[model samples]
Target: MTFKVGDEVTLSTRAGSRAVVEYGPYGPNGDIYLVKLLEGDEQGEVFGALARVMSTPVFRQGDRVAGFGGTEYSIVAGPFTAHDTWYVVKDDKGQHHPHGDDRLTLVSRAPKPVGPTYELDGVTYDLGARYRDKDGDVWRFEVINGEPRGGMNGKDIYGYSETLAEVQQDYGPLIKL
Candidate 1:
């Protein structure tokens, strides 16, 4: 298979992640390729060094590669309740991390009612993402989409957002990259 740097490739198998190529090493013994894989992405690239080429390579940046078996993510769909597992409430008889695990953490933010989904540029994305409610709590909804900006992750799938009241007043939610 032909591949090159700056290529946008996905897993051929059930791979979860995608990446832009950074390096490829080849030699008389065999050919090797290096790719940057995102942690959240599950699909990974695969090819044995001993394999023989059967055709001309034509891979470029943003080309979709197939058949990669990558890691999967556990995206729980729910109104999740996170508790302080380590800190004990003295009067309520609630015990802190009695096992000394010290795994307690504070809630950064919680998500509100995530809305539906939308698509742009032939891509789909979640409606509500990185949401912050009236209480200053933040939450994230997994409206998945493709890697944009050539595999950069900061692009919000929903574009931009406004409050329900603002949206109603304006007749729609604000969408921008």
Candidate 2:
């Protein structure tokens, strides 16, 4: 039984304890498995188990799930297997968290973001609006080729948002110009 990362399997040592394979095939013949226990007193702890102790993950990418708390919903970002397998999940607040599958329950999928443009307060300021920062440097928001762009003193500012509040937040105090 070859166990890959993110595979859900039962631990022989822990009896009915379920775990997800974090890494494996480490020993001489490639049978030792590093897994995170999913239940009992040792829940959430990682341990090295043999190949005969694990199974496979039942969930797939894009699956909606909620943590054991079951309050907030999230989407599975898929398993990341670098040093260990981490089931990555993106929550409602757009934050990602790693968890064992045993700690998650299937839930209704959430809606995806429509696009980059979003309403902040109610007023959508026009592009090309100029503002002077605290340092007295003037910046302007411009849309070139239908894409939002920001420039300060003839230099392009990358990752600049087309919002007034964002401009103020990034460049410090700003006076409309």
Candidate 3:
């Protein structure tokens, strides 16, 4: 692929070496890139290298990234020359997929919800979560459309809570029925 100025690249012959593409192509050397080396003994040095010998890897190995389709992938290996600087990534199912740097975007990972699902007394609760009512009865709480609802048989319709803590506070062990 054609590279423009400010693109991060590495050389095919040198491992762990990085550079930044400076000037655009010019003349018979139109395929050659003018770059400032970012690492190695040649750090801070400016030189020209053939475009075919340069690789542009957008991220380091072991980064969690997402493609345009929103599929999450873990970068396993790469920036090696196999037609180009390709990154090997693994999916949730442990399947391996290859991608170029330009195809991915770094994204923040979402936190997994906690809870083991609870079933106590006659109440069945999802995620092992429960609250004690004023009558000393156990109730399960669920959030629906941003509203916290409570019930005894996994269907809370009698009591409503603005938050999970509110449900516990209003109907907890400390509260009297």
Candidate 4:
């Protein structure tokens, strides 16, 4: 199969080695290709390999994935090559890190939003509604002046169930007014 530049592929001759298609297939049948190795001792080295010797990568950049057998998700930092299986991940403390792709599972590219309606204390609250938290702090459950309130930061409130109980179960409790 023909491969393009930036495509992460494996080489038949180097079994498990990852490389990126750098240059052309100048041979008569367009089978020859120049690939740069992405892993091992020869990382950054280039070589000429036949089309039959190159296979496409299993994962691509921007793919949402989970690693370490955890529920937290991360984005693929780049092409999944032997050397850079790094993922753009954030820890519990909200710190970013490059995580390895061991036992990684692909997740949906984006989560489904739970909509702007929330039910609490037999009352329904929509976006921009004011609510009191357990700490007695009042906040609007909407984006105010381009800023998020009531812990409605994109990551904190979006993609959760529409029920207040469900949201509280995941993101701490918020008392009803």
Ranking by TM-score: 3, 4, 2, 1
Residue lDDT tens for model 2, 117-139: 42235645445355567765566
| Weakest 10 consecutive residues of candidate 1 by summed lDDT | 71-80
- lDDT per prediction? 0.32, 0.62, 0.64, 0.58
For model 3, which pairs clash?
117-127, 117-128, 118-128, 134-177, 150-156, 151-156
**Per-residue lDDT of candidate 3, residues 1-177 (tens digit):** 678999987677555356799886765958987888764345578888788888766666567899779999988787667665678888999999988777878775324335444344454445334554565444555656644566542233543434445555565542211
lDDT per residue for candidate 4 within 1-177, as digits (tens), equals 578878888775774466898998678998998998765446688989988767764345545666776656555344334444445665455666666656567775545333376555665666545444444333345444443334431124433323345445554455443
What shift in Å separates residue 118 of candidate 2 from its native position after superposition?
47
Error of 1 at 134 (Å): 19
Per-model TM-score on C-alpha atoms? 0.26, 0.31, 0.47, 0.34
The candidate 3 region of ten consecutive residues with least summed lDDT is 153-162
lDDT of 1 by residue, 55-90 (tens): 112221112222113211111221111231111211
Greater TM-score among 1 and 2 belongs to: 2
